[model samples]
Every structure is written in C-alpha cells, then in structure tokens.
Target chain A: MPTYLTQHQNRFLEELLDWLRIPSVSADPKFHGDVLRAADFIKDRLLEAGATLVELCPTAGNPIVYGEYMAGPDRPTVLVYGHYDVQPADPYELWTSPPFEPVIKNEKIYARGACDDKGQVYMHVKALEMMLRDGGLGAPCNIKFMFEGEEEIGSDNLGIFVKANKEKLQADVILISDTGILANDVPSIEVGLRGLSYHEVEVTGPNRDLHSGLYGGAVMNPINALCDMISSLHDENRHITIPGFYDNVADLGPAERAELAQAPFSAEAFTQSIGLPAAVGEAGYTTPERTSIRPTLDVNGIWGGYTGEGAKTVIASKAYAKISMR
Target chain B: MPTYLTQHQNRFLEELLDWLRIPSVSADPKFHGDVLRAADFIKDRLLEAGATLVELCPTAGNPIVYGEYMAGPDRPTVLVYGHYDVQPADPYELWTSPPFEPVIKNEKIYARGACDDKGQVYMHVKALEMMLRDGGLGAPCNIKFMFEGEEEIGSDNLGIFVKANKEKLQADVILISDTGILANDVPSIEVGLRGLSYHEVEVTGPNRDLHSGLYGGAVMNPINALCDMISSLHDENRHITIPGFYDNVADLGPAERAELAQAPFSAEAFTQSIGLPAAVGEAGYTTPERTSIRPTLDVNGIWGGYTGEGAKTVIASKAYAKISMR
Candidate 1:
C-alpha cells in the first residue's frame, strides 16, 4: 500500500507555505532583506531536516545555503542543486492572487514560485526527511545541498563557488530538481540542453525626443528605425539573418531526429494546449525539431520614447529592446 | 507679428482637456466603446475647426476620422497625419495623475495625449481657427486632415487608406507633429526614419511545465536554454554574432560619422540622464553611431512559465519573447 499523508507531511507543507510567503526576489535589489530572510529560513529548514553543518554562504550578491547529510565516508556522494530566489512579479495585477501569498487553487498551488525551484527544492527536502525517518540514512549516495539565492538573477557566484570548492562539492553526478515534466500527468526526462544569448539595443536619432511637426520629414524616428532593424533579423522563413549564426550549429542525425520525433506530440493537441492558431516554427522543421534542435531569435522586451498614457506626438529620443537567442 | 497665444488659447486647451479624457486605447478590445467616443470627439473638433466635409471612415478595425479644409485649388495641398487613439496605459499606477485627466502641472499639460498627436493636432485646429478669424480664408496651403484611431496599434487601416486614396491624399509632403523636441528648451528637427521588424518566439522543450527535481539533469530548462541562447548573440565587445547581420549595412563616411559624433552629447550627461552606472554599446563607435546607423537587437519583452508571484521550480514547458529591431 502507498504511504498515506502523515502529520509530518502536513507540517512540512505548512512550512513550505510559510517560505512561499516571503518575497525573496533576487533580481530586484529592493528585496535584499527578504532574500536574506529566505536564506535564513532555508538554513533553519536544512537543520530541521537533520542536515549537519548548515551554513548561509555569503557572496557578492545573494547568499548560498549549503548543507550536508553524511552517512559514512564509504558511501558515494551526490550533490543536489537548486535556487531559492525568484524573478520579480511585475505587471503585478495580472496575478489572480498575491504573488507572495501561497494560495492553493484547483489542486495546483498558484504562486510565483510554486512550480519553480522553491516547490521542487522542497520536494527533495521532504524526500530526504522520509528517508531519514525510514532509516537514519539518505540514499546509497551521500547528499550535499547547494541552494543559491541568486539563480533567478543569474548564478553569478556559483561558478566561483564550484571552482573554489571542487573537493567539497565533489560527487559522482549532480542531482538537481530544478526542471519540470512534460505535463501534469505525464513524466518526462530531458536529454539535451540548449544554449542562450541575450542582448539590449538602443536606437537614437535626435539628441532628445523631437517635435514631429517641425522635423518629421528631416529627423529619423528611432522607433521606426529600430523596427526596421528588428524586422530584418529574420527572413520570411524565420531563419535568423545573422550571417554566421548557423555556422557553429550542430545538425541532428536522421536517426536521432526520428527518435526525438517519436516522442508523443500532436500538432492539434499542442495548438489547443497553448490556445494558439497553430504551431509556428522554422519553415522546414517539425515541431519537435524546431523547438529542441533548431536555433531561434526572439525579442524579449521593447520600449522607446513614450509608451505611456495617451499619445505623445513627440518622436521618441530613443528606442530600447532586449533580445534573446537559443 | 506672430499670432500666437491669446486668451482663447487657454480656453482651447480647456476644450482639449475635455476631449483627452476619453481613454481610447486600441490594443485592447475591451476599450471599444471608449475608442468610438474618442472618434466622435475628434469629428466634433474637426467640424468646429471649420472642416466642411467630416466623415468617420470605417474599416475592418478602428474607424478613421477624415476631414477636408480646402482653401482653394491653386493652393498647395498638405495632408496632416495624426491619431486619435492611445496606447494602453498599463503599469497604470506609475502615473502621478490619471492618464486622461489632463492635469496641467508647471506649464505642461499632464495627460496621455498631452504632447502626443492630440496636443499637436489641437495646435493645427487652433492655427486654422486663427487663420480663419483673421480673414485668411485662402490660406497658403489646402489642408486634408487624416486623423486615425489606430496609429497606437500600428495604423493597420491607415496603410490601406493611404494606398486606396493615393490621389485624394496626395500632397507636397506629409506634415506630422507626433514627435517631441530634443529638450524642453532646445529646438530640434528629425531627418531620418527607421524601419521596424517585430516578432515573437516561443521556445519549447518538454510538453508541459516540469518538476525540476525529477527532470533537471535530463531535460532542458527552456529558461536556462533561453538565457544561454540570448547570451551567445553578442561577443564580449557587444558586436552581434549573427554571421551576416551587417552585410547590407550602409556604413557612414568618416565626415558624416564625425559630424554625428560632434553633436552635443556627453557620456556623463547621458549616463546621468538615464540613471545608469555607465553607457555600454558597440565598440569603436560613438553613442550616436551605435543608436543610429548601426543595427542592433533587444528583447522587448520575455516571459515563460512561472513568472508569477512566488518561486515555481518549474522548468517551463515553453518560454516566449516579443522582439523589435531597427
């Protein structure tokens, strides 16, 4: 029979709810205190979960929560990675409920970090607790927990930490619970990872926003100039226009591509799932190929001049955009 | 003598305030009624400005307000382009006053349409009124007013209207006052217009948001993958890495480049103006060069799974971004 929910499980979930209530957003410096509090909270939980030598490791930015559960020197070691920090909840009104207030709705917990690293990180802690109760030992592998508070911001210090403490963090393979499954009911394993590139561009025409009436014919509108530049990045086929962008791209073999395609995917189902007219991707590739193997460029955000209240007839002094590539 | 700013000027501003109060945001369909009201208000204003033939040209989308003030056949025809619609006043709370309230603080009117086409459009109407009252019946230019209600939403119909009514809209030059000046005091002129390209990219990995714990090692995190891809687009010097991005770029000559560089711009002043640590851009170019002649990329907006309230340890099934270029 499956183990039923116990009083301990209820208590564990309550603690998680408490942790979710703190807005430990590391991306915005305004949440600096909250991040520290969250770090302390995690450290306390680590101690409660029977982890020895729990410490809040400081970094140039946010701190890292480090802990260990040693069975014996003879056991193999396993390092677990996770982030406790989160992105800022802006355009905040879109949320059905407050971001920091943990709310369980329709069997799914609806909060900023519910399905993100926080909830996943908690699962590992709970699993560890279950193991401790069953037998005062973790898995056959000795476990080390490294939870950084700046993963959402970018694990800036993690590289240094990993390099400096290679011996301390050594393990056979790293176990991280920071990704997700294909669906709510279906389980999946990710076999490959894609790389990323990000950039911000600013376009300026006049030294400042100009009067369109007096200068419309003579002065360049940065926003219009920016739009033209962005539009040219992709051809009608949606391939990135960067000359040598695809030079380093590795093509998937037919067999490997077929294997990936074998994964259950329906164009109709995918469209319905996302509420889109149809699946859109590189002109010649299947949905899976477009997503998993193909490179893509996207504009993450853009603004210039006055994107404000009513119309401002002023040609904006500058236009700005953030781009991402994968 | 310049016929400007009589006691009637204050009253005309007051009337414009009344018209500006309507929140005619075209991007959101929910503001359909508001948009209609704004159109009617513009029609009324045109009629008041002695336009003989005023019509609201309906299209598949928003209606266009068309008016004619033909002084005589001998006079040069001037087509005035303006928009009655406004952008969505989101992040709405950021406003010091209500977007549509038309609050006059200092000498500037504070409202969504204050400096935008509305205020500028009003200037033309008032100018016409001054001309008419002063018995300048046969004005220097025959005016045709084309006030669109969808310029904020890309002027989807204006392009069609311009194409369809090429003969009717023909003019010596299009006069638009929908832009602003370099500063509050400095007079400036715009000499060029940039083109635009806008696109959205959806990067998919697994079929659904996954539990990072179980799938972190094997499955790819679209967010991580996205970041990596974005990071790869630019080299250390901030040059775009897309292979042939600069193939079609028209390089400015040294004299022209030097002239642009000599334009009154200070790195420190620019940095302080935008509140940044320092300016960063493409190396070996002046700030003006980077913003003007050079092509650039930016992520206009980005979102993936769990950009919500709290931390969600979700390896998002997909990540999305909106990009624009110039």
Candidate 2:
C-alpha cells in the first residue's frame, strides 16, 4: 500500500491538475460543453482504475458518472457520492494564480477544487486502485462510484435518481468525502450536519432609482431602510430577533458542551488566521458551538441601490440581499 | 406656488442631472476625492439656494454637509436628514445608459441614484429654493438641512454626528425625504420605518478549497454546507427557523392589516413590474403586509467557491453570504 501510494502521488497530482483545468461549473448554463468534457474525463479515469460498467447517466441538468466493481456477494457494499461540477469562481482578480492552472505551493495543491471534494474523492479512487494493484481487488468492500455533475447547483435531480435506482445504489453506509476537518492540524469526524434555508429579499421603494437630493426626505431609501431593518434583527446581546425562531432549537447539555469546548481553540490564533479584529457570534455560546451545534444567520451577499466603481447619488429603486441559515 | 413649481421644473431637473453625474459613492475608499468634490458641489448649490452657515463637517469615513435658515425664533423647526452618498454601481452592463448620464425616458429620470435619496432629497432643496424665492421661507418653519455623504456605507459616522450634535440637530419633527411613494401616480407617505440587522458569515471546511472527486465523501463542502445551512433558515412554510428570533415582533391588529391591504395592489401587476415568475413571500400575508409590516429575512448576496467566467470544479474552502432582516 505504501509503495503504491508513493509511486502514484506525483502522477495523481498531475492528473488531478489536468482535471482542474477544465471549467466544469454546473451552476451556469454556459459551461454545458465543459461539463460534458468533464464527464468524459471522469469516465476515462474510472476505466483506468480497472472499473467495469462505467457510464454517464443523463439527467435534467448535468450527467452522472456511475461505475461498479463487485468482488462477490459476501463483500460489504460501499457507495461513493461525489460531483465533478464546481462552483463558479468569481471576483477572479482575488486569485493569486489562475484558478484553473493548478499549482503546487507550500506542499499544497492550489486550484479551485484542489482540497474540496475533488481531492478527497480522488483519494478513494486511488485507494481502490491500490487495492487492484496489490491483488486485493477481492477486498472486503464491493465499491460503487456515483459521481454527479450538479451538486454545486443543488442536487436537483439526485434525490430522484437515488429513489429510482435504489437497488443499484444499495449500500451499508453512504460514505461521502465532501466535508472538512475541524482544523488544519486536527482531524475530526463531522457526525452531525446542519440544514439550510436560502432566500432573496427584494425591497422596492420608488418605481426606479431616484436622486437622493430630491427624494431624501420624502421617500424611503431602500438601502437605508434595508440597513435599518437588518440592524434590528439582533439586539445588543447578539441574539436573533425573529419571533419564535428558537422554538425547536435542541439545547446541548453542559457535559456535551464542555467536551466540545475542550477542542483546542485559541481566539488570538483564530483571529490572526482570519485577519479580523476579534471573533463574534451568539453571546452565550462558544465559537465552536456557534458554528457547529447552534444555528446561525448571516448575510451572504447584499446589493440594492448602487455598488459600483464610483458613486451615483441616486437612491436605488430596489435593494437586494441574500441570506442563509443553518 | 404653482407658478414657482412650473418655472423651476425643467431647470431643477437639469441641475439634478448634473449633480447625479458626479460619482460620490462613499462606501469605497477610492471615491474619497470624488466625495470631497461632491461636497463642494452641494455647498455651491446650498449657497445658491440662499442657505446661510453652510459648511462641510468631516468625519472618519465621509463628510457631512450642514446648513441652516433661521426664518424666525417662534416658528416650528424642521430638520432634514439626507445623504449625498450613493451605492457602488456594479454589473454596469445591466444599465441601459451610462449610470452617470441621467436619462429621462417617459418622464422618468433613469440613473443610479435617480429615485433614491438623491432625487428625493433634491426635491426638498428645490422646495426650499421655491420657498425662499416666493418669500415662503419665512412662512412657518425654521428648516435645517443635514446631509451626510456616508449613508450608503451604513451611516457609520452620521450616527456619531447625530449623537454629538443632538442640540444643533433639534427639531419638532425630523422630515427626511429618503423614502418613496407607494404608487407611481398616488403620493403616499411612510409613517413607520423598519429596523434591520446585516451580517456576513464565513464557513470554512478544509484549510483550503478541495477537489470534489477526492474529497466529496470524506469532507464537507462549505458551499454545500452553507446551502444546507441556508436552506434550514426557513421551513416548508417559508417561516424563519431561528430560535427566539420573533420574540419582539409587534403584530398589527386585523383592522390595521386590512387597511394596509387596501392599498392599490395586484398580483399580476406586481409580477409584471419586476419580470418575475410570480410574487412570493410569507404564505399568510398580502404583498404589502409582507413588505411593510411583517419582518422578513432575505439573502442579499451570496458567493462561494468559484463563480467566474468559466467553470472550476472546486468545493470552496469558504463560502460567504450577506443577510438583511426587518
């Protein structure tokens, strides 16, 4: 296993870099061809890994890559879920290097999908390859790989596919490698996952963007009204002010809370890492609890009136914001 | 009054166009010089409008323009609050004409800040001029104009200025023309204002972005996790799920709600106005109630992973979102 791991590390990195170069964002329709090309790339890689019955399953949005490797009926069956699609890389100027030009810097592969599910999903493929080379193809697990191309957009069709192909995707436990460690140095398992609600709010004031000087005193500035509305969501204590929001919140006991707090956390270190003044969250909870156990609300993106290069004194006719909760 | 209104209508419109041409966005630091230039423009305009004691008050972020006209000691005082700042105009391609070049089509001025506080606020300035020219300035009120240049950036310094100059800014009723009319033809006044809370959230999974293929099953995609988290904010009924969020929401009586619903509204008309599939909001309330009386949560903006011109199949290490509440 060690020999195989060492022998293929460089080649695996090179192949992954090539894969990263293809723009396969499924969220956007303009990348339809790129997504198809990515599907082909994954199909080829699965075949190279000694997999049989590899095919691209067509869906409403993007294609799903499926393959099977059955050792015997007695073996434990494992189903792997992944996506070849990625999120759109925007604010492109923020990138230190071209996002697609995967680079190896400071022992880390720098690319858009380097450390995300791509790197982790590839690890399992490599593990399967290692088993094949070492004459362990008849290992304990009968592995099945199911890679989709639209998880980034919201696996709109995945649930339907799973329901329809229950027998094909049957497994003891669905093993997914799309999460992260608790920290860079500490390896931890994510036992619980939070749910989400995404929404866009449009606050329309006037019929169109108006001049602030002419309408400042008579009309509502949606941006100002938006800011005022947002400011009132939390009180001085940092608690969300929506009515009945906490009715179903399951509280954590002191013991569990204490154990979670024992995880090594340094405020100074965390602040330095993020380049922030200080960490902020719900007042009564620790940072870990605020992020992991307790639910949180945040503004993901906001724009209404004017968010441009210079300034226009016109009041925006409408202000918009995107919010998320967990 | 009609004569004065008619005489200055075209001139007022032209002058405002010139003012809108100056980009005075205060949120961005690069607009520092432009902001100063805008302040000078306001000062010259105020002088022309017969304002005495007009000066620009400097703050940490943007400058504030203050002016006063003391008609008499016994008259009622009206303090006007406004902002000369505008939002950043981005996605510039979306504009039909240059955001700075104010265009009047179908009797409506189109520009970035045309209908926002700039246009709204300018009406008061024009009204003040009309009052002074028609010898109506000494009619019944002592008007004080307080225009700040940082309203677009959260009014960070204006709050401090307001707190510091409480005595100087005293008035019986603070008349701000920053809101808009309920309908295009019917003039409406905003009697109540909504409060707000805005926040940005960052979710980190791995130390860096990962490839979905290798890491899909083993690790968490911040983008996916963020989506999941966001999806949980509202329930199947679209009500927010945050605990204790609605503790302070003041519910209006049925009569008040009914009266508000009487405002001219049509589902089809509203839908056609914004070019949306349909008008959507909290299930139980009318559109007017949802926008005005009821507190709401929305995702103002959202971004995570790669959102660029091309696709990059990366699970982002971090995902960000902005949320607004009322």
**Model 1, range B150-263, lDDT digits (tens) per residue?**
876556677898798888788877888875455656565556654444456667777655434333323344544554565566665667788887788888898988877666
lDDT per residue as tens, model 2, A173-234: 77887775657898776667555554566677656554443233234446545555655565
* Alpha carbon lDDT at A312, candidate 1: 36
Scored against the true structure, residue A19 in model 1 reaches a CA lDDT of 87
- The per-residue C-alpha lDDT of model 1 at residue A42 equals 83
Candidate 1's C-alpha runs over 4 A off are: A1-5, A134-139, B1-326
Which parts of model 2 have CA positions greater than 4 angstroms off?
Answer: A1-326, B1-10, B134-139, B309-311
Candidates, DockQ: 0.06, 0.06
Q: Candidate 1's C-alpha lDDT?
A: 0.69
DockQ of 1: 0.06
